[model samples]
Target: MREVAFIKQNKEKWLEFEQAIFGNLKKNPDDLASLYIHLVNDLSYAQTYYPKSKTVVYLNHLASQTYQKIYKTKREDTNKLIYFFKTEVPLLVYQYRRYVLYAFLIFGILTAIGVISARNDDTFVRLILGDSYVNMSLENIKDGNPVAVYKSGSNWGSFVGITFNNLRVGALSYFFGIFLGFGTFYILIINCIKIGTFQYLFYKENVFWESVRGIWIHGSMEIFAMVIEAAAGFALGASILFPNTFSRLNSFKIGFKNTFKIFLSTMPFTLMAGFLEGFITRYSIDMPHFLSVFIILSTLSAISYYYLIYPFKVHKKINLKNT
Candidate 1:
């Protein structure tokens, strides 16, 4: 048959094949096996009837790829896990570094602005933190404790509560990417400003180093996760703005998948941050200086190694392999 004649004769079958491949067909194991058989038959028909047509060419390619995947499912499963860690995770970490740098730069500038404003005005902390919170902190500081707020709840309760809250925030930060990433940016800016203002308050009280050592014991992990969340948001946003070779819908689907992976990756860090904040921050003043420094340094080191060093190492290995 001629290409046009073949397409017209088998158009319904082609539609069914397309639906099976990309539509919501709800395939059980038996149904999946039947669908694969149908796909193979359709490809055979297209090859026989319209060998030179684009439809035939595409169907041939699709059938070949699908057959390989279906036949090697068990083998691919193991390789896919290895591929995710060695390739996908490292690339994600690398993308997050750019977002981290952006967040840091913005926060640093805001911090400088906060410090300048605080130095020039006596009530800047009260303005930034609200009068009530400042009063409470001042009272706590007067009692020789600056971070007593975290110690109010039972440790286990605090851990569960704080972990749940952080997870919610991280999930929201990711889900908002469905709105094209504006929500993530909004959250990031608000958090960054709060940190800047909060730190300036400590600086104003001449307790900057003490506050840094206290807060950053957990803040390093918490803040890095936030930046990673923002990077996921960027991926979602960029998928919409620049679909590249893929259709907009396809790009968005891929972007959402990547972003979801990144969101999942932040869970452990979120829990660790919660633990430090709820349990460790309360005793910062009592903890040995070396221990506090060590926690902070260790947290930073882990961030550097995971996001920067490890990713570069993986990329270098991949490049060497390709060469």
Candidate 2:
């Protein structure tokens, strides 16, 4: 069938679904579920036959909204917390996956610029990292403990302080998106450049391996969570910039709800990173090389899987159930 014909046939049903979704009309859970299943079938048909048609897009959007409505109606009976992490956030992440990619690409570019700038200009590291930090790191390198910075405070104190600081940074990275995402970009620029510059300093001192072993034991999850936070911010910003079929206010509301879930998901990983930095990173200097590598890889893999791989898995599972 032609796309126009397909849309014409389904248009009335889609409108009624939208009215139930967006209007003041309240729907019963079972009725909503029935409608949702019907909408999903239409969406599947449109995707297969109409492919790139706006009808498919419209049907898909309606199906998603209907699914949410069904979930909301059933929320009273479900374990909300488990349902949140297990299903809601992952769906939101998959839906806005592009923002994550954009955040990482921007971070990569800024980091590269930092590395290139530091490589060409001897003073660039000091300018970015500050003279005091450079001198302290140089002294640490001379003393054969390139990451001794993590050893300064008591473990408990360090954990609390580091965790609080990381939380604050993540919050800023996300809330700053209100400025249409430039504020979030600014946050990423500051941190990513510092990362590049800091890593370059160790490389310049010929202690790259030492720094990696020491820093990355916790830095892996810590850094990855920060990037995810930035992605959340970008998603928030994009809502304002491209409201699409939504009013700017409604778009921002939906964007904030979904993106905030993504931001909230990073909290556990951030805390874990702080714990490693406080207790484990201090031992990285003398720890077995294999052990350090394992910790680094494990933390990185766990966080990466949750944000990247697990979302896809959850999305697939949900889609299968809908089918």
- Listed in order, each prediction's TM-score against the native is 0.71, 0.94
Candidate 1: residue 142 lDDT (0-100): 77
**Candidate 1 clash pair list:** none
State the weakest 10-residue window (summed lDDT) of model 2. Answer: 56-65
* TM-score of candidate 1 to 2 decimals: 0.71
Which stretches of candidate 1 lie above 4 Å from their native place?
1-87, 95-103, 110-124
lDDT of 2 by residue, 1-323 (tens): 88778777877787778778876777798988988888888888888987887677667666766787788778776788888888787878888898999988998999999999999999999999999999999999999999999999999999999999999999999999989999999999999999999999999999999999999999999999999999999999998998866689988987898799999998998999999999999999999999999999898888888889988998788788876
Residue pair clashes in candidate 2 = none
RMSD of 1: 9.2
lDDT of each: 0.69, 0.89
Candidate 2 overall Cα lDDT vs. reference? Answer: 0.89
- What's model 1's lDDT at 132? 91
Kindly provide the TM-score of model 2 when superposed on the true structure, using C-alpha atoms: 0.94
For residue 273, model 1's alpha carbon misses the true position, in angstroms, by 1.0
Candidate 1 global CA lDDT score: 0.69
